[model samples]
Target: MKTLFILFFSIPLLSACSGGASKINGHPNIVYILADDMGYGDVSCFNENSQIHTTHMDRLADQGMIFTDAHSNSAVCTPTRYGVLTGRYAWRTRLKDGVLWSYDEHLIAPERMTVASLLKKKRYRTACIGKWHLGLDWEKDEEGRTLLTRPIKNGPNANGFDYFYGITASLDIPPYLYIENDRVTTVNIDTVEATSGKGFWRKGPIGDDFKHIEVLPRLTDKAVGFINTQSKQAEPFFLYFPLPAPHTPILPTNEFRGKSGTNTYGDFVLMVDDVVGQVMAALDQNGIKDNTLIIVTSDNGCSPLADYNELAEFGHDPSYIFRGHKADIFEGGHRVPFIARWPAKITAGSETDEIICLTDLMATCAAIVGVDLPDNAGEDSYNMLPVLMGEKIAHPIREATVHHSVNGSFSIRQGKWKLEFCPGSGGWSPPTPEVARQENLPPIQLYNLVEDIGETNNLTQQNQQIVENLTALMKKYISDGRSTPGSAQKNEGETPLMMD
Candidate 1:
């Protein structure tokens, strides 16, 4: 790890923009809960017109700061998770587009420093308690087949987590089983097939005890249990709870099926909210609520599998005012609900429009522990600790942020001007790949988001100079191997001149 920082010395030192007082007396227990496939408007605190009743999520907002301009580093699951853990954009790696399947090799290189790894340096007991879509290194059998029983490598435990209990991929992916530490919990693995048009799960092998409907509750129970036990220890703990609900296999428990009164998807969102409430209650019961920094957010925007059309018919809009859904370059695809509550530090019920990315967690956590991060680590992360502590800053936290879609399309946002490197949605939305080419649409699209929040018009033709400036900036960022000001590090692979 020391050698990794050798090249980072040239990075400029970062200072927290100060105004408000921060009451961080000592180390606090950190609980970062991530919801899957949840849109920005899915939470009532974010969207006034949201039909889904999220009592618990709203309660969380009332107790913390809600960020109106927060986003996942990527529009899809795997990449976003990668960015969350590594604090580097996924496009910088070999995975240029799409997501990793259940059996894909580990995405995190062995040497990379993750948020868990960074916090462990501060003597915090770290645990990841839910979905880990970022690829894992599964052992091989005698015949070279994927060996599930053997101890996996380059996984959560190997990547700096002191303990881990979670699924290997999305609930819809194959080889459904529970992993505790580095090994699978169950010995039996029988092939089973289950399908749903709305839920969208691929049929594959499963553990005898694994049930899709029971996964959320089971994960929540484990999280609460971890919180309860860790609370007794003298050392502070960091729990990374990445949820696996409201994505696919939208299985809301029987008790919550009709709770939302809109659809199964809406009900599942409510169920996610309840899970948040349960964690909050656990913290309270353990007498660690005030000192615990509870952050509740989603991996990305809601997936289309949730039936947006039907949701609208029921007067509920998952994407709300944003156009397009998950996997697109639009705000609706990657912009998600972000809330942080630290009773001892952050002001309650406050809000900020501070542009931020989920990847920034690494730098923020590092700041919390008063550790200086090397340039090679968290190349794209900006320290938002001041904002988290409710400090009013004079300047923007980030100079520019990059956005990636499922199809490897790139978009860069600097202030209110955004430049997309591709035409159409750059995802699953209308103007299909073939249609985009047939219609001979412009190769790039630019938008002045300040004037057009819905992205109803393209300003590429009118602002050629701005387009050129943004394009040059994007190229420089990719070529420099980092978005932040630092000694140029090495990228895992070459980024194409055109992202495609």
Candidate 2:
């Protein structure tokens, strides 16, 4: 105990950001709970007028810091997840637009240092439970076959995790099945019909035990089980629980159905809250609550599958004051709810407006573990530990945060100035560039988010100098192959649409 305390305290705090809670040990159990396609306003704490009652998420807010200006690296599931694990923007990879679909090859390279892999190096038992939208190289029966075969070429297990229990992609994506470690638990493959609207799911192969409705509950149970099991062990563990819920097939269990008094999607959000509660309960039950750093956040904004129109009838706007929704270049697309709780290290019920991206998670964790990330790893990630500890800082943690849309549009934000290389929403939202062209919209857009949070006013024509400066920075970031200061590195693949 004395040794652990001494080692933990030996790392000096930033002089600017002084004072912090006394921690028990240097190593704390890290449970990163990522929600799929959940919007920023879905949480009651984030949105005062939210229709869905997210009690557990609200409770979590009361116990942690609420980041008013946090975002996923991209405005979609797979990309944001890629950024989360790798600390590099997904845009830097070959996939510049859209997401990896069913049976797509694994996104993470074998040699890449993933958050799990980094922790494993530190002797932390790592596990991933829930949705893995990042592609998996499933062992196939033939070259082009979609059928399941044993010994998946790569998955969460292959990347860095010692254990993996989850689906390969979104709940709606086909070939739905659960994988334990490197193998599918059961091969009793069956066909499922494609459905559309509210409870939508693609028609494809499904395992015998895999049910859309049972997935969330099953993941919750597995996460709780993992925590309980790991809590008894001496070595700390890292559990990456990414829930596949409130996305498509918005299945709120029978007890939760119609409970939100808004819509089925609202009901599903409620169910997601329950899942959060269960995980928190597990931590408390196992007596690891204080020493465990748990973060609950979404991959991106609320997907259109939630039926914004239907949700609005109940006086709900998942994007809240933000302009657009998922897959767009707007704040509504990438800006997401971010709350973190670490009783041992972080101040309670605090709030910060520090601009942060999901990609920053890697650097933050690396800082906590006292590991200096190599130049090759977390190239775009920024360490947010100083800000999280409530230390006063001279400037923003991120020099400028980059945002990407599903259609491959790019935007860069530094301070309040934002520059977008797109004329439209840049996703499945209003006035696509094609329509914007016909409507004679500007070829690009810029906004001072400080003056316009809704992104209502376009200041591109008026702010040419700011536009040029931002555009130049964006170009430099691209050519440099990284956002952070490091030796010049080559981007994995060609960046899509260099500039407008």
Candidate 3:
């Protein structure tokens, strides 16, 4: 383990690192590619023992910086996406548990300030090109039946993106069709059989051209096309390429079907890596590689559907050394692989252990454009530009990062000590919520992550004082509404925190 320090003077380095005229107005083109239910160990570069090889992801990591301790704001898709774009925890909103389904109302309010909306203020061409699980408003017919004719009123287009090319929710959900900007490309009048067991997609109405296997490839083509188009423009652009693979209906294209030498999920990961290669090649062909800042990360940990038993037989532990998978409060659920490539700025092959959350992107981008965000916005985001520039920031960038599970379980982390408010996994591990309550398990659990990264030992009974301190801090963060220093705001609803 390396002892890293934060030295705050990195703004000057940003200017010095600006390579040439390729930079548009002192800012680089930003492309954020988020993977769905991809594990930290899925990428070979992140885990040496990983059986699934991701050559493109490895090369990208070698060319840039990797955050060893990076995490998504929540251990699920919709909530994490909301936190990433809005710079606030999703728990603060009305959706405290589970996720948004297709045909649900838009989660992002019309007045909410998102990363896309914020970047638009600086004249950046913004586009969201895949898996928009944050929710949308659907039109209805005279008979109260859902209608796909009219364009969605408050979707990605209304939330600040100039264009939106993606699906309304997970590929497994109903009304399977592609959405361009605000309108569905075609109406879903035909019903598709349930693809469960093979991958797990519910039976629903699907568009004529909407094939489960073709979604990833089509999205890759669109993302590459968007990059090529930007080459002709003088303004920097922001592309949020959220992939919808390795999550459900693990349908790997024919070309990538047998590539991983593992299961279908592994093959799907290889397909995702190929998409990364395509995006990188597009930047190269456009001569924008030097001026483009590429980011690759996952929304959360791997899902159980990836076939943990089969993968383990092949020497691949998707969650690496962590205990639980996707929805747990443990490391495996929230910690994800994060790699950033900026040829004009970041040193190649650099790695950092700085604790950071996905929500930090809002403030990081704000700092890149030299804009001061209002006190009301990006309240939970911290500027990690210094870390990106390989400089040590003077003050602590974050006091602590809060973790959320699919079941609305809450956990707080400050340095090495972590306090989980729930007794069991709070997700999908042994002693299910029902079982834990029946057996009369302990009320809370605590772990010093520095000593026990696996969270095998519980220190709650011994460290009552530490537990009390962290518990108080979590409460304060909730009451204050905003985590970072700013004006205190009001939570959209009361959080059902079980803390006494």
lDDT of 3 by residue, 188-265 (tens): 468898877748899888888788888888988998898788756767778888888778978987898888998998
Q: List the residue pairs that clash in candidate 3.
A: 6-392, 6-393, 7-392, 7-393, 8-393, 8-394
User: Could you say which candidate leads in lDDT?
Assistant: 3
Residue-level error in angstroms, candidate 1, position 1? 31
Q: Point out the worst 10-residue segment of candidate 1 by lDDT.
A: 1-10
Better of 1 and 3 by TM-score: 3
- Which window of ten consecutive residues has the lowest lDDT sum in model 3? 1-10
Clashing pairs in 1: none
Q: How many backbone clashes does candidate 1 have?
A: 0
Residue 305 alpha-carbon offset, candidate 1, angstroms: 0.7
| Regions of model 1 farther than 4 Å from truth | 1-25, 497-500
Q: What is the lDDT of residue 331 in candidate 2?
A: 92
Position 213, candidate 3: lDDT: 81
- Which of 2 and 3 is ahead in lDDT? 3
Off by over 4 Å in 3: 1-24
